[model samples]
Target chain A: MFQVNADVIAKEEVIPGVFSLTIVSPVISENAKPGQFVHIACNQGGNFILRRPFSIHRIVPGKAFEILFRVVGRGTEALSRVKVYDILDVIGPLGNGFKYSERITSALLVAGGLGLAPLLYLAEELTNEQVKFYPMLGAQTKTKLLRYIDFKRIGKKTYVATDDGSSGHNGTVADLLNRTIHYIRPEIIYACGPEPMLRKVAQTADEFGVKCQVSLETKMACGVGVCLGCACVTRQGYKMVCKDGPVFDARDIIWDKEEIEPTLLGGYRCETAKVSDPG
Target chain B: MKNPVMPASGTFGAGREYSEFIDLNCLGALVVKTVTLRPRDGNAPPRLYEVSSGMLNSIGLQNEGIDHFIEHDLPYLRQFDVPIIINIAGNTLEEYAQLCREIKGVEGISGIELNISCPNIKAGGIAFGASSRLAEQVTAAARYNTDLPLIVKLTPNVYNVSKIAQAVVYGGANAVSLINTLVGMSIDTNTFKPHLGNITGGLSGPAIKPVAVRMVWEVAQTVKVPIIGIGGINSTLDAIEFLLAGATAVAIGTANFVNPRVMIEIIDGIESFLRQRNMSDIRQIIGKVKV
Candidate 1:
């Protein structure tokens, strides 16, 4: 991994509180892989010392990369206020990312809100590899949704899920996956979203006999393995999310506890209306 | 010595994680995580709770034990020319002595930082550091087993830290490092629940630097041993502040996670700081604060 002072190339407000920041970090971008993330310095060693970790949303290889995040914490709020010429100390191409298998012909891409960040890069890579992929995009409402249009430009149609039923399916993408996973039956499922959604996805994929990979998030100090603070519980005991993964096989994750649910509108909201899709 | 800049124990793992980003030989010393007598799984998920300026981590001294370190980690660390200081923690008094005896047989380790100040674990972590009697007993137990330069890492949770520093010194500690993370807690504004899995954690980063400097100055007054000051050190000026407060050296903890090059930058900045002041050596600034 390499750390570089990247100059902000562009900043755009995707939604009201959501931002897409593009930076000229050739070293990181060139070395980056899909599902791997970069640690962005929101402030110097002032009020907040930990650098905010963001998945590589998109890459302009040999030139730049983009990170998509919502104004959830004070750190992201500080990040949203940055202008074009500002410099950010970014350390990246960190952690193990998604690994593609040649045996796979079809795959299902699932995301919840900003969870779409890393999957967007994954989609582009899959497109280049001539793999047919279906993306399940979820949001609270139509305006709050992200990256479906970006997925459309790559290939195929996106399966949209909105909590308010403003879009395709009238529920979480996990609920949608349960409903249609049998009919669609992609070779493997890849997901990144709220923990509750991931739990539901893992369960659905298991029942349908589909392999899955998930990108997990936690309260991390070092975006490397040094601190061992960001522990992701799995069948094989505790693993460091920063080094062992931001990505892992979904079946291997032991998803217990109530951290967050469908994560509607970037808020940790718990709502349950799950009907096991008898598909 | 390359420079008086090293990572605080537990904040830095076996030097393998950062080996990709930095050369291990550039450090004044290499202090690994707090190794225990047995393998510890550490705390559950959400081991970290970030606050305004720093963070609270209740990692609970998670490690693969000293046996794993000797078999797995020692060979990789042997390649570095830097003096390796293993940070050892134990669940009991005998465990501390046993760990010292085991590490003494290892060829690469130059010193031992007895971690009596870890606030997360239950059995005997901060209990020993908080009480002068227990601190003295633990320090002596470690010293009796090995002739390694013993540095007792002090916590800031005590009422009078200087008393404990004096006790450890009297018990045969060669030097001291202050302060380990302060005992702190955080509650989620939304959930109204404790943020960390251990409910409370040790606070570290720039937030605790002032407390660390004050403790270093206090402990420096009570003992003649060299003090390695650690707390919220992020820049060269922060490191220099510790030295002026009577710390012979400083260890950077949370800042290493922010910018991996922070230690290197501080080394370069300190050189320039001395050059600007027309000083030839770092000792000129150590405890040189004007009254």
Candidate 2:
């Protein structure tokens, strides 16, 4: 939990509404772990009040760190305005990250759209460890896919799926998983994507008797666990995503349907665990 | 004696939330959220709604109760040198007394702030806050139970806040904190309906600052006890206005949502202003009425 003023070294529009920001923070870059995030204070002293949380896409050793995100709302829109050399107040390397085990020789990486951010670092780490990586990338279209060259360079076998059949396999990534699960026979599966995608992966992994870990996203207030705003339903009960986990074993989550139903207002209903008290 | 900056209860939590971005020890003091006899789940979803310049929240004082707080939060709070003001709310006089009695021996707790103005829950919610008699009774009951300094938190929705402040003071309150979030409502323009799940909620932010400052001035002139002013205090200038209006201390509330580091910024701004004004100490500006 360190606050450092990071300078934007590079900003690139990877796809429509999607961007990749490279910030020069050696301290954060050297310490960041896969699945952890940095809270980027956008437009300091401006109207954008809260800091935007972004998953660390890739940590470039001692040089800098990268965050990939989509311009979903005002916070991200303000972040998109940031240019090269613009200083940002960032607090980071926060929340528990994926615990990579050396016993797992073969690994499966599943990603949907921008969920690919955190997995990129895990992929790099896996390659460094000489672990077999089977990367399953998903996007609405070929244009939405990111870091294609990087994945191709490192992954032992990279599979791609686009919803519109614009490129790669003409199906969802889950459909591709159904076809490739037997061939890869991965020892462990790691996934970060839409809840539906993660649910499908979780169910599939359970059926195949393979261990699975998932990263969840929730509405957060204090990213340090005090607010209890970013809580999720887990097997044990309610657990704060910012503290107990952003990453949890798929079997550990409760995944209640009624709680996750879309609210009358357009936004998703907060599916926080039904804790007796939130303090 | 006056113009101390304090963190709003519940709004500031235990200060650990912002420890990542700002140092909690630098602030004058911090007010932890209202604790109860038992853990409370609080209100349902849609507890918060954004209005023009402020927001309404029906958080309902969701806390881990007194016992859990004493065991878990107090030990962590003791590490900070700044004073820790514990805020406690109760459904009955006995409950309030029991809570006070329990905190009497707590080592880290510097003071106790009686939350007499929670609008979210139906229990002892607005009962103690809406009347001068009940406020006095609860304050006196709490005073009898504990030897710690007591500050009575006043609701802004009352008819005459000065009367209520005076009542709490007479009841043996060491201090008074004014203008707890005002009762407010917001409508969804499209649905033509109330926005918040609780329908009515407490409003806090820059929108209510002026009202809060006026109330602080009114209560300051009438009550003998120290006043901690709160409402929409997002900056040092805001804090200064409350001070000039007669607040011994000011609490930062809704601004935490807008920017987690706003408290540190206000502290720095106040220090800078003091240096620029050639003031030697913070006490010089506390309640120094211009007229």
Candidate 3:
């Protein structure tokens, strides 16, 4: 892991409140792998103490990367106020990254809401590696839906599900997976999103007996493994989400922990994952 | 110890998680989380919540029990050149003695830090540290079982922290580390619910530094034993503040979360500061705060 002062190369409010911040950090951008994340310091000390952890949304080649986030709290709010010239203190290329084998030829990319953040990089990598992938995106509505056409550009086929029928299937994305897993015949499945949606996706993967790798999100203190603050249970026992994995094998995850209250977006009922093309 | 830069108990796990980020041998000491007599499941989800200038945590000292520490965690730590101090807790008074006896027989262990101030657990945490009588009793129990350097960690939740420090000193504690996270709470404005799963947690970070420094200065005057200052120490300036306030050593707790190399940085910074002051020994500055 490396800590560096990344200059804000560009900023775009992809949609109101949610932002896509491109930053210049040669060391971190070059080393960051698919599914790994960067912890960004929100402010210079006062009021906001902990650095917020963000998924390595996309790597801009050798010396830049983008992180997508919404201004939900003070930290993000502080981050949002920074301009193009601002410098962000970032520590990254952290936790374990998603694993892919040379033999795998086809795969399914599943994401729920902001869960789409980590998978776009995975999709781009699979494309580069000569693996065909079917990308599935889900959200609460059309506006909240992360509309990225690049998934279709790089993917063999793209699928979407939203709760409001604002854009693909008018149901949960897991339901879409259940209905279409056979047609896709993917050799591997990769996912990221709210815990509730991930739980549902795990069920679908279990029924089909496909190997699924999931990137989890939790309220973390130290982005590193030290705090044991971001605990996720597996068959083995409690594991630090930041260390043992922000990514884990689908079958090994034990969700017996109490149901985390619905997230602003992650908390979507199973019905939200279905997305339709805005076109 | 080369310097006072150490990871506070529970903040830095058994030292394996950070092996990739930092060299373990560079630390002044390595203090592991509290070892219990039995395996603990710990608290539920939402165990952490970020607040203004700090964070609240309720991990509840989750551990695989003393057997795992002695057989598994200890050997891994001995690889590092740093001294290994095990922070231990018990559900009851006798359990403290038993734990000390068990660790006393173990090899490669340097010292035992009695954690009588964990706010999250129901038994034996904070309860003992909150009362001078119980604090002294727990210290005496551990001191009787082992001749190893005994350090009693105190909580700041009490009315008179100095009295408790004096009691532990009288009870045979060789050193004392003060202020464990102050008990705190956070409530979400929208849902009108508590932020932490446990409803309350121990607050740590820059937010608690002033309070920690005050308590350190207070306890330093009352007890002659070495005082290991812990609370909101993130930088060289913070460490120097604690040292000037009469701390013999300082542990980096919440600050380690922000920068993995923080302890190393602080260690380097203190050397520079002392060099600039033309001070040859760290003791020259320790407890030398001008009145």
Candidate 4:
């Protein structure tokens, strides 16, 4: 929960419109965990006041962490032009991260497009804990699939799925998971992606009797709990995604009309199907 | 006094949310989100859109209503010693009076901040504050309903903020909080549609700071009641600027989203500035800005 002016040590375009920034901030790096995120201030001047939130894509504990973001709107576009050594006011390692039981020996990591950000970090955490897992990367096409090479280096095998049959499987990633779950028999499922894909994954996981944790996204003003802009309806009540979770149990989300109100992306197109993903 | 630093209503939900990151007691006061007469789901999604130096939000005053606040939120807030100013808004004057009456005997509440100018909603929001007569009517109605201190939170969207401020004071408001979010909107050029689902929202953040300071200064000269300056106050310097412009206190709104510890930081900064100046009290600097 510390706010620091992090020095951007490295910045690269992971893919067209998508960026990865490696920041030097020991406090945040040391405190951050998988599935947690950082809310970054875009610029100092009045033009970009709101801080944009990004999941911690990766971390190098006690030294620095990485944030992966897509150039969606003004904030991300402004962030894309930031050069190395620029200071970013970042407050985070925020929200509760993914939760898994110690007894779970086998896990499945699922991601949709840029949604792969947080799960990449979670995969590393699971690796360190000796939890055997497989990574499933999904995109609209082969070119959109991100970090497959990276995932292969970490997991037993990185499964690829594409909506256009441009890569591995020809259907949605959740369909691929549904087909493979019987063979893998994973004890738990962890996912981060668009809501529809997440919902599908949650359903499939339930059908297989496996526990599932998901990282959710919403338009947030304050990434801390103060602003209720990012409220998500749960079985209990409206929960602040910035505070209660950016990560939550799939079963807890209502996914009904009440919950559906805040999840509206307006006219923003789905980034997965539209954005170009690098294989 | 604990350097007048409080969370602006709507920006700080129930006190429980930020309690983990901030000690509630450290603030001069805590202003909860607007509580209407009944539970409100608020506006549709796409509730927020970032603008030049701030963001526009049409949260539509969403809350669990007054009953839920009294039952669930009040207990949690009562644990903290900080003065609680419950911000209430209504679709009508009766609703405002009813809310004041309902909250009158609440154990932990120190005052009620009548929300006369919430710009997001389609109904009673900014409409009340846009006109001096309606603003006075609502203030008088709420004032008659309770014996508690009444603070009318004014909207900056109006042409004459000072005129509205004076009217509310004449109607029996003990104090006034200036510059609720200015009404603004954005467009999604790609889709050729308005950015916010509600079509418009109240704009807050650093961009609104100048407008707020000007309004506070104007209202200060027009009315003798204390003014709680709100809008775009992110640091101690901004708070001091407001105080110097004639605000007795300042509320942190959009800045709370950027930094949870902003109010505490502002409080610490004010004390430092006052101590450095060898001023014995903060009042010496209030409205001290020289032409």
Best by TM-score: 1
Quote the lDDT for A245 in model 2: 77
For residues A163-182, write the lDDT of model 1, one tens digit per residue: 99999899988999999999
User: Of the candidates shown, which would achieve the greatest lDDT relative to the real structure?
Assistant: 1
Ranking by lDDT: 1, 3, 4, 2
Candidate 2 lDDT, tens digit per residue, B2-84? 22777898777877777766777788898898888877665544566655566677766767678899999989999988899
DockQ of each: 0.34, 0.17, 0.28, 0.28
Go through the candidates in order and give each one's C-alpha lDDT.
Answer: 0.88, 0.81, 0.86, 0.86
All candidates in order of DockQ, best leading: 1, 4, 3, 2
RMSD for each of the candidates: 6.6, 4.9, 7.7, 7.3
Q: Fraction of true inter-chain Cα contacts (below 8 Å) kept per model?
A: 0.59, 0.14, 0.46, 0.44
Worst 10 residues of 3 chain B by lDDT: B37-46
The runs of at least 3 residues in candidate 1 whose Cα sits more than 4 Å from the true structure, single-residue gaps closed, are A258-279
Considering only the true interface residues, what is the Cα RMSD of candidate 3 after superposition?
Answer: 8.2
Candidate 3 is graded, for docking, as acceptable
Write model 2 residue lDDT over A1-279, tens digit each, in one string: 777888999999888788889999888888888899887777545543455678899988987999999998777888898899998888777788877866678999999888899999999988877888888999999978888788889998889999999978899998788777987899999999998889889888888888899988865545666655455666554567877879999998867535633321111123233343375
| Runs in model 4 lying further than 4 Å from the true structure | A5-17, A24-31, A77-87, A139-145, A162-167, A170-188, A195-212, A233-238, A249-279, B79-81, B271-281, B289-291
The better-scoring model by lDDT among 1 and 3 is 1
TM-score of 2: 0.86
- Please give, as one word, the docking class of candidate 4: acceptable
State in Å the error of residue B244, model 1: 1.1
Better of 2 and 4 by lDDT: 4
